[model samples]
Target: IKPPSTESVAVLQQVPIKPLTKPLTYPSLVSVVEFISFGRRKQLYAKCPTIRKLEERLPYHLERVEIETIGPGYIILKFDNFSVGPIGAYRNEISMWCPGKRVTRSTNLSLYEATEKFALYNLSRPGTTIKTLETKYTPKCILNCIPLTIENYVVDGNDRDKWIIRTTRPVKTLQTDFIIRHDTIKYAKEVTVTRPSHLPIRIHTDILSEWNCESITIERELTHVEVVDYCRKVSKRTDRPIRSVFKSGLGGYSTELFQMLSRELNAKKMELEGFFGNLIQCATIYINESTELSVLMMEPEIWIEVSTTPPSTVLQPIKPLTKPLTYPSLVSVVEFISFGRRKQLYAKCPTIRKLEERLPYHLERVEIRTRGSDYIILKFDNFSIGNFGSNNESNGKIAMWCSGKRVERSTGQSLHEATEKFALYNLSRPVTTIKALKTNRVLANETLIFLDTPKCILNCIPLTIENLIVTDFIIHTDILSEWNCGCITIEEELSYMEVVDYCRRVSKRDRPNRSVLKSGLSGYSTVLFKILSRELNARKIRMTVFGGNVLEFANIPINETTELDVLMIKPGVLKIKVCARRTAIDRAF
Candidate 1:
């Protein structure tokens, strides 16, 4: 029972093998086939897998077999049957399988071999053959007979390929010549063959022999040359004659004259001394020459030698002295004289004169003698006397000498007065002094006589004083005694008065005061004050009269109509008050 059960189990596991699955065949061919062949022989190669499989299935009686795998992943099956035809000739047949299927359908392949000869037909129709030719060949016998000849020819051949046929040529072209010849061969033909991939293969052919040419000459012609005689003729024909005409005083010679004048002027300019005055002289002469030339061709040469002379010695005219002559009296008296017409009269009796009659009064004779260039001696005699004493009772000895201007004195009242008055007066006028050397008494109202240094007198009074004295004495005669004294104190007072009066007169006469409105209140009030302060600090303006407020004297108007922003005690501190209608800006004057 166990054996019969085991057999049944084995039968159940076998299940009859499923009928072999349709003979285990591959799919039908779905891609085209291609083949390549060597010409004139049965050397066909299958370039596609479908064609290769088909050829592999063929009987071994057809040809020699080879299998090649091409670079693009295609298989080739080559069969050679050399006895069938020429070295290279074949037809290609292509076969392909249907889409979405394996390569199992078998058909002829269409293929091409690079070495196969192809027909080039005319462009008009498919059946028209333009030409038919075999691929070029050299017979083995010919090649063997002249091995060295062929080799030498090929080594020096014009064609760079060095083919076996080139070895038979008689004359070989050099490489450089070959290049040049090729460039000049315009009849050369080039063709391009494109594959289904659109890649092109270029072919070039030299058809010189077929085009009726035995040989080609690659030499260039000389197109341009310069012959010596031709060049000489050209140069001579282009050459110009330079003719210069010299005319003597002719009309057409203007340009020549102008050129000549220009050269001469330039030469003269080069020789010039470069002083502006000299240049001006040359320019003037040039203009003059140009003007003359413009008028006529031949103008007379006017040569003006303009050499400069050294500047002449200039004598400054002497300025006549304008100061008045002053003399000192022996008895505290003063006198003055003009220096012009009365010069000779002063040598006789130096005295003052009345302003009206211009005559001397209170006569007292005195003689003056010059001791040196600047020293003098005076002699007084019988001088009339008044307040101090009689002239006969006083000593007659008096002398005088000149010195610098009197700047100071010792008498209290007179010195103070003179200093104060002269301080102002000295701003404009200067004084001169003469020292007395002898004692002389001069009355208050008598003519004062000045004596020589040895002996002289005036009313027997001594004329020696520290300050200058004025006298009431008048000049009644044309003598040295025309001066007389007033009071001594009055004299001092008069000196102060003279200085003050001179200052006042000069201040009034030289610079008069204009109205504030005329000068513009803004200028004197604001601008002038600032300028004055700056000038005072710089010592340009001095404080001369110090007793009064200058602002009050300036006479600026002030009224209730004016407004005052602030009353400034000093520069920074101010008293601020608002006025209804009295601000300073409202003021008109």
Candidate 2:
């Protein structure tokens, strides 16, 4: 049914949300004055004229102006042709209803009521003039309502109906807690803070000092005495007192001068005059007379200065000390005798002379005979005179003689040389004879003989000689005969006979006697008796036993026996028997 009268729906207009802009600029001087004189107590000064005109036309006493399209809740306001300070400069931007609001704008309602009562009573009471009235009511009300409190109050001179007020509520407590965090930073220049408790505060005017300067942070409760003591210690460390040691030497200065000076300098004011007087006296003495000389000579030297006089000395006679003699009588005499006559006697009676005289004539004869190099035969004549020469001819002269195969009168060579050469050719050759002949005519009678020879020539004599003779004969029949005889005839006849006779005599001496009584005879007696009987028989000495048991050799008794002769015993049993020749005799059994 409405289609015959169709109609249009109405659309409601949506208002644009505008950012709230704070009034942070000063108005023109004329406008500010006019606004203060008028009753516009809550007016804001915009920096821009257009923003200020638009804000003045608003119906509300409190208004926000947005001058640019920055974003929601952000603004740039301009009023009175000046720059806007910053966005969010107004007090209303801070949320007073935030959960953790640090500061509040509202006052205590109870305290505000009490304060109003006090102010109203004080104003209406009598005798309360301006002079007697206290300003406590104004301070109390401001403390209660901080945000709405009037910062400046003025009375109007022309318009008695109007009162002027200026108010400011800090948006934040100077943003003192604002902190800029950083990492890895080094500061080259000094940093300063105007107010250390207020961030974004005017720096130079308030703080005006270098940052990070070294300083001691003492607690507030430290006493003045403690601070003074601490400062004294620090001053001591920073500034040390000078030390000087004074010694005496310069000019006539002595140790006393230094002592006086030190005392005067260190004395208290009350005592300074006394110490100074003493110092002056010391200085005067040090500068006077020979005191300078003493100081100059103060160093040690070889010359010693004596303070006392030397004592007198007395001379006395000197005596030498002597020691008694310790010589012994026996020792003195023995030493003298040994060095005098006794020494001479010992020299004359030495054993060498006795030994020379005591040696046997045969050894001397052998030594003299062997003293010369001559194969000579020495012989003794009938007169026992010694002589020798190299000759095979027989001479009838009877004297000691020596002969050789050859003789050299010029070179003193003889047959001994030839014989020695011959023995050298045939080592088995035997030495026949050695003789020394007289050569010195002056001593020929007493000392020289055919046996006398030079001592130098005796050392070469060979050991093969069986017979050696030294004689003083010119001719000897026996020697001649012996020379001619052959060795076999000599060995078989004369030598053998001599040997047999020697053996017989030795046996006889060794034999024992058996004729003695049985009790007196030892076991050797029978053996010795048998040996004697055998030897006597071997010698052809006949013996016969008589009835008296006497052993008779050619009717003579032989009793003595020789030593070292072995006796043989006949092994047989014996029986006691008795026989009688002239008388009965006992016989061995």
Shift of residue 97 alpha carbon in model 2, Å: 99
Cα lDDT tens digits for candidate 1, 96-121: 22223222222243232211111111
What's the true lDDT of residue 273 in model 2?
A: 19
Lowest-lDDT window of 10 residues in candidate 2?
Answer: 293-302
Q: Which residue segments of model 1 deviate by more than 4 Å? A: 1-345, 348-512, 515-555, 558-589
lDDT of 2: 0.24
lDDT of each: 0.24, 0.24
Over 4 Å off in model 2, which ranges? 1-458, 466-505, 508-589
Number of colliding residue pairs in each model: 59, 32
- The TM-score of candidate 2 is 0.12
